[model samples]
Target: MTALAGDRLPPPLAEGDRLTVDDLALRVRVSGRRKRFALTVETDAGLTLHAPEGRPAAEAEEFVRAHRAWLVAKRGLRERTRPLNPTKRLVEGEVFRYLGRTYRLALVADPPAGGKVNLIAGRLVMDREQAGSPAGGRAALVDWYCRAGRAWAGRRLQPWAARMAVPEPDLEVRDLGRRWGTYRPGDGDSSVGRMSLGWPLFQLPMHLVDYVVAHELAHTRVLGHGADFWRLLRSALPEYEERRSELDELGRRMWMGEMS
Candidate 1:
């Protein structure tokens, strides 16, 4: 880690590096460049401001204090659910809930040759015959998950899009480091749009995955979660709040093991 210089120890954050304003909430992240300080805040609803690194602690607190009312209001509306972390996730003998159905993670060794791979009786069956080494087993499992995830997304999003009277956006699997999914509509044409869906693994519930898809799809019409956007989303999925809560809590758990 790099340390701040003594002379520039208390640099003030730049205006460009401020909070983000989304339709739903305002949030920010603080960072510092070589010799300058920066803050970022996002707020479509209220305001979120990020503090720059190496800034005086008091100044950072004061910055937040200046926007305390907005912070308090948005914080109250923020999702409070917790996500699953790396330590608690496992491969086998674990019960996972997806699409309201429970499945168990099963690890099976393949023979020395080759065959098909599948998940049977809630257990992921590996073709030991195709295994070149013991390490390949985990790789094979993740591959299976990627394949399953792509196919699953296609199947689920198709009908939903048709019912919602929205054209299905292009779907692709990605190894996004931070976001699970994102939507990008054409400059101004609602008819033209694009979306990217991430696949951390297949352990997450299908509803959560669908919720993300729906969220992104809604962005095709509403760029941000303003009142109109939320209203449009609610009209389609009355239980969106519950789904969001579920994802906020259990989404990270799915990616806990075999990755981090």
Candidate 2:
């Protein structure tokens, strides 16, 4: 008899699994480095559970069942706060947001040669040619937002960096998907840091904008959201928690691009 392969090998462990709890489906992932189990609910990704490696699958299912009430409530809240997908056609009377203000689009033929966008008299004025085509209109609008976002960040970063005692990091405004901003630290002591802020931030108020900047700057001192990070952030913005809450509430609406 050949020494059976099954007798010499250990049973396979589940690295990934899925289960349903109270009508909510959860994606379970087992990680070798995870010391404890945790659950995260995201707007786009739904529910996910992380368990310590080699833990019995039955234990993970039981954990979900234990927190069934909390999971159901959180998922319901996420659905209520989901952003609306507004019409994207570039047309006159359409609304766009900037620096927490809504401006209506106004198409004009004053500048016949080239197309441009400008916020004048509470209106986003655009050349007729630019407004006639969706691509042209979106490009002009996005270009304006990018320029304005950079200028706005430049003005705020200097003061905040000085207050936080961190070197001013390079700023880049772009779509950051689900994130408001990200801080990329350089390789070593001699490296310069870079911070990429989402253009959607322009749709929020200045106080909230400052909170995001301060949050990223604080990362320069502490990498994680430990007690030290909160302490440092509080020293700069005492009401940061309030601002953060407001930001979260307004986040979906801002991304919707609808008139307030």
Candidate 3:
């Protein structure tokens, strides 16, 4: 949340902050230590310009112009690899998955107390009134995922924590934007930690869900995705690389509450 370039340059943003070029919609980052300007295309197709502190706006603009050709090609490559999460229609017989099992939407006239989805007889029984509208159906379905995912992850957390030999952190399941899961370390003396998983993760197979949980649990012992972290995770799950690949491939295609 650094500075965005405007007519007049504001004071230098905090070290290593985001500056934006409105024309290209690419971000400009200013760092005090940076001596040379560099261009990078983020995995998510985000363009970034790493420039030294107090660089002129015109100069930055020129740097971007010089690299426009390369930028376009790199961006195209990134766009091809980015996830194309499909939207749901929220109608009768619409397909959904829960832990790798397929269930068709079955709208029922009579809904229970709340508009939560029920897994009854291999069908996702949702309220017809609720599913009549895209907004309501999307909300109801996401709520179901959050509540159900919490319980499932809660039961599965302790076992993974025990296997990893790390203290179990508080777990939450909800929309985490583009990330599958995240973990924040707590003070060692009293706090264990905090872990969050996107509700959409529940749509993946159990093994992949377990992979996300275990991946976060490993952070309890190791911080970054460095060699030490991978080594620690490998000790617990020998086939972690395979699981990671599967999750990456399958997770992107999972339903993310988008409606048609």
Candidate 4:
């Protein structure tokens, strides 16, 4: 006689499940290592609920409800500070930033067959065909920025890597959400280490970009921002503190979509 097959079951939900509390939706993350529940608000990851292992989901929901007021305020603050993903019209006279300089967008009809964006005479000139729509113009602009940012970082990385005594890793320019940059150390077998920098860095001054590069390079030695990390960073940049403060102020404005 033939045996009947058993039905496959779905995997059980773990700590990092999505939970809805009132009008808000939150991510539930359980940490066996933590002693208490915690709430963290980030620009990229909105609301995260960190609960100690074995806590009931119902209790977690109640905790979130209790902190609704705080969550509302934090959400508002993040919305104000986070980068504005504005809808672009891609029209002439629109201003965009490059290497901390303002460049007005201008359309040009040219012999160059394929569409391209060129920085000419302090303006971002694009082929009329490429700048025909908002989406196309945005794509062209972002593509150009990514290429420029990678090259710029490569030049800065050489000196900073030499000073930090770390081998220069690969550079990647992309939208890193809320983070400006991150250093990922390579695992021996499979992973090759690299630095991922936010494309928005091009909007800031060169000094600020250098500071970010230096900060990530320091992570190659020390993983955390401890005293040793600060000491090493200071050895390389004496005015790191001031630069950091300035970046923080400027970064908010840049993220908020203010080009001026």
Candidate 5:
């Protein structure tokens, strides 16, 4: 199941039992007070529901039946937005994007004595290139991407934070799969003041990357995305709605395989 942001839980339900509006294929949850019934619908496109607790099941079912067409359309839209998974694994000859352009992975090995990987010319030349051994080559490439991402994220965020009236946020670049970035509120004297930026090697644009930075920075003042949290964010980024969609689309393509 997907997540609902900012204190938006399915309208208060009873014992958490669910009923599927068979006519609409929409899922309804009965919860909160025994008398109160909540509705939750699942569609990949997004969530849409009309919840009225303390209503009879027959009444709730009728409401869902009336919206059957809308529910179907919503599910179809969500399915289209799901992340794409390629059948082929990442390897040589595979195309990957960086800085708005695409590059093909090429393996080459010619070392003086020790192994090293460097971006020579336009290709990723590996000093330990063994056709059967892709581990070393992959490590070199991932390291390169991490370095590039850290520099790119810092440069883009520094100026934006300053202009928005937020304090300078320290940067920590690391590989985080579950989350993209986070803001850490400083404790007392010795605590470090900073933000943690996660750089997964993918082709997301600079504006979308900055959105995450701005999102965390706003947390410094308004810990949650209540109405005030959104207002604070809009003050810095007026077009956040568009940016959020872009990130969701691009963030899905990022690969996170461990290098051996």
Candidate 6:
């Protein structure tokens, strides 16, 4: 990218080329539909400048320079919210979370008669046999999360769907690796969509969980995270940006089946 003259624009960037903005390295993404430059700060604090196709590199540089203050502030926030993917041990007093609340792990001699694990007296109780084996304990805990997450998400779906004015899709909680949630629209013989939320998402606070629910609901009407999709989401969750930021901060710390 180079300084421009008269209506001329720099040659389009190559596949792996980077956009250089003084002191800041930015990835350039040219979107034909975008009317103005858009700057994105990712969860990892990576920078991307989304520009309308054929915009001069100098113009993009000026835009980034003008918004340097905002980028700096957002980078600071991202730095403060760095990833903390902590591993867990099945020993007593090991912490677990359910809907943003913490509960300690407790070992018991006998299995609770009905299940591999149980929330007894605000502690996650597992029989000695299960807790003694990390693999067994982890499987039992994830099963609990899947069951609990499905039940809770089931009850909350109708209300959020109503608020978003979209039909509630069939909800399933499972291990959707690297994604908090996903919506699969119906096809072929099925007319109803199915929304799959990761079981680990159940460990976040209710508000953050709701954020993901509403987010997928928005997809019920709009598929991509384009302007229209965000606009629809904003209409339903006015404070979605804040919720998303909080989710980015705390979600990385949630236990994702890692055991020690």
Comparing candidate 1 with candidate 2, which one achieves the higher lDDT? 2
TM-score of 3: 0.71
Compose the digit string of candidate 4's lDDT tens values, residues 1-260: 43367854434225879988988888878877988778988886399988887666777778899999999899987876675443345678887777788888888878244437878888888888877665666667777777888989999999998997877777899878758899998888356578999887887889999999999998887888999999989999999999998887777666322222
Better of 2 and 6 by lDDT: 6
Best by TM-score: 3
Cα deviation of 45, candidate 1, in Å: 26
Q: Per-residue alpha-carbon lDDT of model 2 for 1-260, expressed as tens digits?
A: 44476675432235556766657788877788998778888876389988887666567778888888888888888787766545555778977888888888888889534339887888988888877767667767777777888899989999999998988888998878768889998788998789888888887888888999999999888888999999999999999999998888887666532222
Q: What's the CA error at residue 136 for candidate 3, in Å?
A: 2.0
lDDT of 1: 0.59
The list of candidate 1 runs beyond 4 A from truth reads 1-83, 87-117, 128-136, 186-192, 257-260
TM-score, candidate number 2: 0.70
Q: Identify the runs in model 3 with alpha carbons over 4 angstroms from their true place.
A: 1-80, 113-115
Residue range 191-258, candidate 6, lDDT tens digits:
98999999999999999999999999999899989999999999999999999999988888888888
Per-residue lDDT tens digits of candidate 5, residues 25-114?
434444344453333434345443444464555666676677677667767776766655332233566655565566665655464343
RMSD to true structure for each model, in Å:
9.6, 7.7, 8.6, 10.2, 10.5, 9.0
lDDT of each: 0.59, 0.80, 0.86, 0.80, 0.62, 0.88
lDDT of 4 at 213: 96
User: Ranking under TM-score, best-scoring first?
Assistant: 3, 2, 6, 4, 5, 1
- Candidate 5 — worst ten consecutive residues by lDDT sum? 32-41
Output the better candidate (3/4) by TM-score: 3
Question: By lDDT, who's the top model here?
Answer: 6
TM-score of 6: 0.70
